[model samples]
Every structure is written in structure tokens, then in C-alpha cells.
Target: MMADLREMYTFEFMRYALTVGVFGGGMLAFLGIFVHLRRIVFLGAALPQITALGIALAIALHLPLLVGAVLGGLVGILLLSTSGKPGHLPTEGWVGLAYASGGSLAIVVLALSPHPDAGALRFFTGDVLGTNRAEALFAIAVAGFTALIFRLCWSKFVVSSFDPVMSQTLGLKVRRWNALLFLCLGFGLAAVMNSAGSMLAFGMLIGPPAAALMCFRAFPKVVVTTVVLGAGAAFVGLTASFLFDLPGGPTMATAALAPVLPAWIYRKIRK
Candidate 1:
């Protein structure tokens, strides 16, 4: 088994997939902490579907799929930002609408393609092993940019998320900061979905953070733990996919859930 694993990395595609799985998983897990904390987990589901629709449209238009996915996700975030305001639809309603609309549009667009089934399957399951250097570099760039923004504005983000009233009292530009955070979230979602597809993106975004929250009380510790566990799951899942000839995205997503189930069970028993 060890020999097989070592030999797998000898292939560039395997290496690229592993690189994406690790870094992309960590990035998703990091942003996921904020998503869970803010009680807006629906973004995880909605944004990825939007991204998928974007990829589908890109395929139909013969454009760059990543660009389409990013644009779609950003548009979804913008619409979601207006949700829950007075006279506006609630966040949940917006998320549901986005998910439904995106999925439907993707299906319709893909049906017009020459190989609709293949395109549809790739959108649903992803092709992590088929990842190239360009996609990996793009993922790295997105992750790095997101980390820099969070590092510089960590305190402000925390204040806005945890205590919006206090943020208003402090004269913080709360709406602007929130918009920035949403932008970061949308970009990160697009990058990850490009490699891991929508389902796996949603899974990594929620599972590791939720599990870490169950095990740790401190915010910093939770962040660290979530990154470690998420990356580890990606590694394991990628390896398993190679060994078992399984789909990388779903396998990785399931691996992410592995820790979550045990953590949830333990927390429930203790409570």
C-alpha cells in the first residue's frame, strides 16, 4: 500500500490533485468557520450551485469555465447580501432561489451540448485528477489572497460577525466590511469548486469547521484544528480515490464527514 501510494505521487496529475485537495481544503475550512459562526451556512450550498451553473454556461458559450464560475458565485453573493433587508427576501429564500435557479439553468445549458451526460457528470462529480498546473496556480492565488485579506482585517471581521450592534456603535463601516467578506467567500468558493466540484466544496466548507467547533472552544484553536482536519481528509480521500478508482470529489467530501460524525456523537453523549 505504501509503495502504491508513493508511486501515485510520481504522476503529475495525482500531485496536482493532492495539492488542490490540501490547500483548497484548508481554505474552505478557514472560511467555513465564519460561515458557521455567522449562522449563514446556506451560502455554502447556494454559492457552489451558482458556480456550477457558471461552469455549465461557460461550456455552452465556449468560454473559460473558471471565469464563469467566479462570476456566477460573485453574483450570487451580491444578491445574498441584499437579502434579509427590509422589503427584501430573507436570506434563506435567496439561497433557495439561487440553488434552484442555478441547478435548473445548468441542466438546461448542459443538455444543449454534444456530450451532455459527460459534461453533467463532470459538473456533478468533478475531475480532481484531471486538474492541471494552471488550475492549481489559480487555486493557490485565490487562497493566498483570501488569507492576506483575513489577516489584515481579522479583527474587523470578528467584530462585524459577532457583534454587529457593537460594530455600529464603534462607527465601523459594517456593511462595507461585510461585503468584503462576502467577496472573499465567493472567490474562495469558485476556486475550490473548479477543482473539487460543488458538492465537495459545500462539504469541506461545513464539515471540518462544525467538527472542530465541537472539539474546541477557542476561536484560534478551532481554526487551526479545522484546517488540519480538512487537509488531512483531502489527503486521505485522494489516496483512497486513487486506490479504489472512485470519484475524487465525493470521496473527499465523505472523508471530511468522517470526523464530523464522531465529533457530533461525542458531543451529544457528553451533553
Candidate 2:
């Protein structure tokens, strides 16, 4: 078993895949804390679909995939954030619209691509094994940058996120902080969705954090446990995919979500 596990990394592709899984998955999980705390879980769902639409457009137009993904995610965040006007369809209404249209349009656009590559559709279905070193490095860079920013401005983020009114009273730029948080979310989602697919990216965003919040009430512990679980899920899912010849992205998604049940059970029992 040990030899088999060690041999998995001997292959270059596997190394890249693992690196992406660990860093990207962990980052998404970390951002998920804010998603949950801010009560914008639906926004989390919507962004990935929108990001997928971006990838499809990129493929159809022969643009760079990463460019498409980042732009798409950023656009989605910007549009959604500015929504919820006095008489508009409400923020959730817009989120639902984006969530519904983004996924469907992605497929339609792909179908209409004049020259679709066979591997292009992997953006939706996921193709972690196809991840290259550059993408892996991108994942690491994004994760590291996210961590650094959050670390330096932890108080401002927490204040702005948990109590925007109070944050404003304190003379902090709440909107800027909110924008920065969403920017991080956009970049992190695009990076993960680029290689791991929207499904795994969303799973990592919601799952480990959900589970960790269930198990712990302390903020720091919740964050640490969430990151650990995210990374662990990636390792387990990749190993399982290798041994069982399963699809890498969905398998990792399943692993990321697996902790929810146990954590919920523990919460119930403790209650």
C-alpha cells in the first residue's frame, strides 16, 4: 500500500494533480467560512456556474481558459454584488438566475463551438489528471496570496463581514473589504474550476467548512480543521480515484463532502 501510494507521485501528472487538489481545495474551503458566515452560500453556488460559462466562452472563442474563468467569475461577483436594488428581483433572485443560466449556457456555447476539442468538455465534467504544472503553480500562488491577505487583514475582514454597520462606524472601508473578499473568492473559484471542475470547486467551498463549523465553535479551530479536511479529502479522493479507476474531480468532491455526515451526527449527539 505504501509503495503504491509513493509510486503515484512518481508520475508527473499525478504530482501536479495532487498539488492542485491540496492547495486549491484548501483555499476554497477557507473562503467557504466567509461564505457561510456571510449567509451567501447561494452566491458560492452561483459563481462556479458562472465561471464555467466563462470557460465555455473561452473555449468557443479560442481565448485562454484561465482568462475566461477569472473574467467570468469576477463579472458574476460584480453583478451579483451590485444586485438587490430597491425594487429589483432581490439578491437571491439574481443568484438563482445566474445559477440557472450559467450552467445551461455553458453547454449550449460548447455545443456551438465551431471546433470543440474532445478534452474541452472536461471543464464541466472535471479533468484533474489533465492538470499541468503551470496550473498547479497557479493554485499554490492563489492560495498563498489569499492566506497572506486574510492574515494581514483578519480583523478588518471579520469586522466587515460579521458587522458591516459596526465596521462602518469604526471608519473601516467595509465595501472595499467586501470587494476584496469577493475578489479572492472569484480568483480561488476560477483557479480550482479551471482544472478540478465546478463540481469539485463548489464542493470544496461548501463541504469542509460546513463540516468544521458543525464540529467546532471556535473560529481559529474551525478554520484550521476546515483546511485540513479539505487537503485530506483531496489526498483521499485522488488515491481512491487511482485505485478504483474513478473520475478524479467528482471523487474528490465526494470525499470533501463525506465529513458532513459524521460532523452532523456528532453535533446532534452533543445537542
Evaluate all candidate structures by whole-model CA lDDT and list the values in order.
0.84, 0.94
Alpha-carbon shift of residue 237 in model 2 (angstroms): 0.4
Worst-scoring 10-residue span by lDDT in model 1 = 114-123
| TM-score quality measure for candidate 2 | 0.99
Query: Runs in model 1 with CA error above 4 Å?
Result: 114-120
Q: Specify the highest-TM-score model's number.
A: 2
Tens digit of lDDT per residue, candidate 2, span 161-251? 9999988998999999999999999999999999989999999999999999999999999999999999999999999999999999999
- Write candidate 1's Cα lDDT for 72-171 as tens digits: 8898898777777767787688889988988788878788865443444465776677677877887788888888888898999999889999999999
Ten-residue stretch with the least lDDT total in model 2: 115-124
**TM-score, prediction 1:** 0.94
Q: How many clashes does the backbone of model 2 have?
A: 0
Clashes of 1: 0
Which residue segments of model 2 deviate by more than 4 Å? Answer: none
TM-score of every prediction relative to native: 0.94, 0.99
Give the candidate number with the greatest lDDT: 2
Error of 2 at 81 (Å): 0.7
